[model samples]
Target: MWPLRQMLQPRHVLPIHFDNIIRINILMMQVKYCAGKNIPFFAQNGGSGWAALNLTNGIIIDILPLNKVTFNTDKTQATIGGGVSVAEAMAAGAAAGAFILTGNCDCVGALGAYLGGGYGNLMGAYGFGVDNIISFNLVNAEGELKTVTEASDPDLFWAVRGAGPNFGIVTSAVIKSYPDSNLTAWSTALVFPGEQITDVVKAVEALRPNLKPSQNVFLYLTNNNGPVILVTGFLLHATVEEGKAAFAGLYALNPVFENSGVLPYAQWNAGAASFCLREQRKPGHSVGISQLHPEQWQEIWDRYVEFRNKPGAENSVVIIEIYNLAKGRSIPSSTASWPHRDVNAQAIVIPWYTDASLDNDAIAFAQKVRNIWKSTETKSTTYINFAQGDEGLEAIYGDSLPRLQTLKRKYDPENRFNQWFNIQ
Candidate 1:
């Protein structure tokens, strides 16, 4: 089953025909046909999800043709097609002089990320991607198109904001956009030798409590030629000096390599383009942590170094993403189904490799890292987007499990849209 799931990914190589869904009506028709026939189906978003799926036998609905992004006249809102990638939305937002809350990566589907509690660089300032959404153009289990908004359907709207894929297929979404006529951000990439892991981790811990809403930092234990600690700090609407001051704790460490500059909003994600490469067996595991333990991170770095040296596995990366959740936390947890508002940090390990022979090795290494993270975690949880499909409902949905389950029974009794994180 694992091998079959792996083969189903990198879908281009499979000898199967897909129904290209370009319009909402067409997508609805396909859904109804598959539901009536009792044939399982999965909708392809950005084609970037690395979770293990049971697409053993199903028709793939190619929603890539639905990719479209348009902003309103005042650049205050955007109508994003379900297939739009983060890169597409970012480019469109840049052209329209607005800032859209999107994931940090470029290739992930914008709506797909939003559906799982969107965490992005701008989330500290604006809010989660789910918070920005105004309404959805959803196609339900019965293949009926429904315009869902807070005023129209509060329950389904709340469900779709966090656990959408399990309820229906959203053809398009209307999301709040901010006008950013001056859309420049300051960012720096800092590299440290593996030996500096403790100092780096401690410095990050010291800075975490002081993180401003306009600032965010990402830490990566990856192979840059060899095992190295990479840190990228970003400050929105700030000068270079301000960016430096915000991350002064890290700068005090005197990194081996440093590159800092102010970039246009369009180029904020340029550094992450390399991570967006498609079609590799990237089985990623993640956890939401309430605190950062420096000693544990040192151990993680040691383990990362050991696995990174393996042949054909140097692309594996361990990333920790931290943000100021004050704004997102300001919103009530009951407002939507996303359950990780109080989590201080999110960590993920991607065991990237293409050799089928190394599948077991990669999974072992990833699980080991996840276990290490869980050992020190006060409350074990995982962001739905970063999950690898091995978690229980409590771990993924947190306290929202009971309500989401009830909504699942109400909205999708037959469980047709169970491709991602199913409610039941």
Candidate 2:
């Protein structure tokens, strides 16, 4: 069989703890050793692979052991270690009767997503993962631990919130927690075959401008024979009545399939993480568009149908996330490098391929699919995790790119952290 015997494995792994700041600084100092040994070093936890399109291949540092969430005495905020997954943070905060701003997927590293303008069902309520951050334990390029906060270093703090990896290694972060006003959470998935994609797109467009702050609707389509599924989730609900109302506009389309229910917040978090990516999937190439225009939507549907016929693309998927931009904008625009706060949503094309030969075609087709939606975008902004490589500075960080470049130089002058998205 023509196959790779094994995936590219890390050559070395360095694990650190929350109590051992000295050890982390020592690991930071190891960069000198890496220089002398002529090896590249990189750090990761949870392995979400959202921070960059390319990955570091040598001397990998596994920072997954720093997985603890400790609340302050007043219980106003919770400090999470870099190794904590979304699931762990939610569990720890739930025990303390607090809700932390977290991405819906429980499997992803909490701090990495938080640093990159993390969007979630609660985004309309809490703004963004970056908005709730208070402080951090950052190891700079000089191998020194610096406590970064709004008062101590406002410029660095602002940059790190959305561009953390571009600056240094974040060992841990302190962020605020809140009370969940909605005692219950609800979600419904509506099924529509290829024939009804146009109607579904228009209906969603009609509702997009008027979507409530507590509601999030996503359009999910697989390259397989499955029908397009429009999933709507409600965060502000005590009764099914509110959830039902939130989805009434879409229900008028008379979906062929539907599933609706309520569950605990923690359960919801786990459910969302496993919703689409239930299995360990192959490395995916993805790109995002700021909004979905009607003409672009039709083109996207046509292109997706064509892509579905391609060999490996059959198992791939397209995700249209209708975000609560109105709510996300409540956070100051200057706080981070994520500049697409006013956009309505994102249309992401995820192309997954197994063999190395299929990689180029998958990425090219995925970029084409994204280009259809991008044509309709008034703004060039997109999410960090949703980006495909070659988008350039404006597309990823928008106007904030210049400021980020200065901070990158000031903090990481030699560009040790450029392995991820770089300011250069």
Candidate 3:
């Protein structure tokens, strides 16, 4: 067997030319183990918090090399390896004349995204990523491989759709695909004086209900030396004229910088990615709320302004993303382990700090903002995907706590795969 010392080296240093040598060494080492023995392994791709948690026990499955995905010609379904990235899946789906519900971050893993309750630009038109999955190829805690679907092992299937990672290791999944449609997406930015925060909120409140199922609107409160209001809207229209007409009302808000036109699906996604790319000044954090009341919005806005004016709060940005809930709300609450489907709106606050000295202050500020919202009767919920490592189990699970705990008892009584977003 190869020396364990060599395997302990950092994987990032492995050269492409020496990959064959490494693979051969691994193959030779495997021969020494017994046929039915189940050896623990480490699994991670992008090394984000989502993946790093798997290495907590120092034993991960290391599924990054297993990346491979295929889509059928019928456009009915596609199977993706656990390690596949959102970018990789998008390219493959485009080639196959189909697409699946995926996140905006191209680096997010397909399995990790869905298992964590994936939300994306297209979620308003489709649904949560977990809702589209048809089946899963899972390796249970006992090292037994099983194919789980609605018709077979219905309970496990339901759990896997939203609560899989907490139960077992999901090696891959087959998800429903939609026929590729050429889309016309447009973007517009309005910059109002910082003092007009109330006006901006009023505009958003008026526009929220008018948004069509095929459109998505996001508003960001930012400051680069000074405060500014920015609004971006995307439409999944079949024609440029239709997109223009659909966005006319919103555009009439008198955007300072507007770029509205037709683009291919690939271009639209790329543009979306570019707009979302922000400097990694510090450890990023966010919070979620199920609904946004007008009074709550005003209170949150006041908090944001106050926080921005504080010392060492220059680069921070507060983002607001609004998408149609018609599609997601249509699904039964029990269809998946994901809760909070019936809420009208969702909001998240993201703040940044450069120096370690300011880290505590930043966290305190975020917590204070969260507390302000929770203290009210809103009882806002948190999305597991955006959760910081320290959030409580009840906060992330919401009303589905009992069902998730029950699945934990059945599939992973020993808690072998309990690293990622663990219940206990």
Top candidate when judged by TM-score against the true structure: 1
Query: How many clashes show up per model?
Result: 0, 0, 8
Model 1, residue 197: what's the lDDT?
93
Model 1 Cα lDDT, one tens digit per residue, 157-253: 9999889989998888999999977888999999999889999999998888789888998899987888899999999989999999999999999
Better of 1 and 3 by lDDT: 1
Off by over 4 Å in 2: 1-10, 17-26, 29-32, 35-38, 50-57, 181-183, 223-227, 272-290
Model 2 per-residue lDDT tens digits across residues 1-424 = 0012124455666666456565576667776666456566676777665333333366767778878789987668999988898889888877777778788778778998899888877787778888888899987776667889999999998899888888878889999887655445777767777777777777777777777876788887763254364555554563677777777777888887787788666776654543335332333334455445665666777776676566655666677777566767877788776676766677766654465676566656777876676666665666776665567778788888898888887877777776667886
Every candidate's lDDT: 0.86, 0.71, 0.62
Q: Give the TM-score of candidate 1.
A: 0.95
Off by over 4 Å in 3: 1-42, 49-57, 181-184, 223-226, 238-241, 244-249, 271-290, 294-315
State how far residue 330 of model 2 sits from its true place (Å): 2.4
Looking at model 1, the pairs that clash are none
> Which stretches in model 1 have alpha-carbon errors above 4 Å?
1-6, 9-22
lDDT of 2: 0.71
- Which 10 consecutive positions of candidate 1 have the poorest summed lDDT? 10-19
Better of 2 and 3 by TM-score: 2
Clashing pairs in 3: 41-60, 41-61, 42-60, 42-61, 42-62, 43-60, 43-61, 43-62
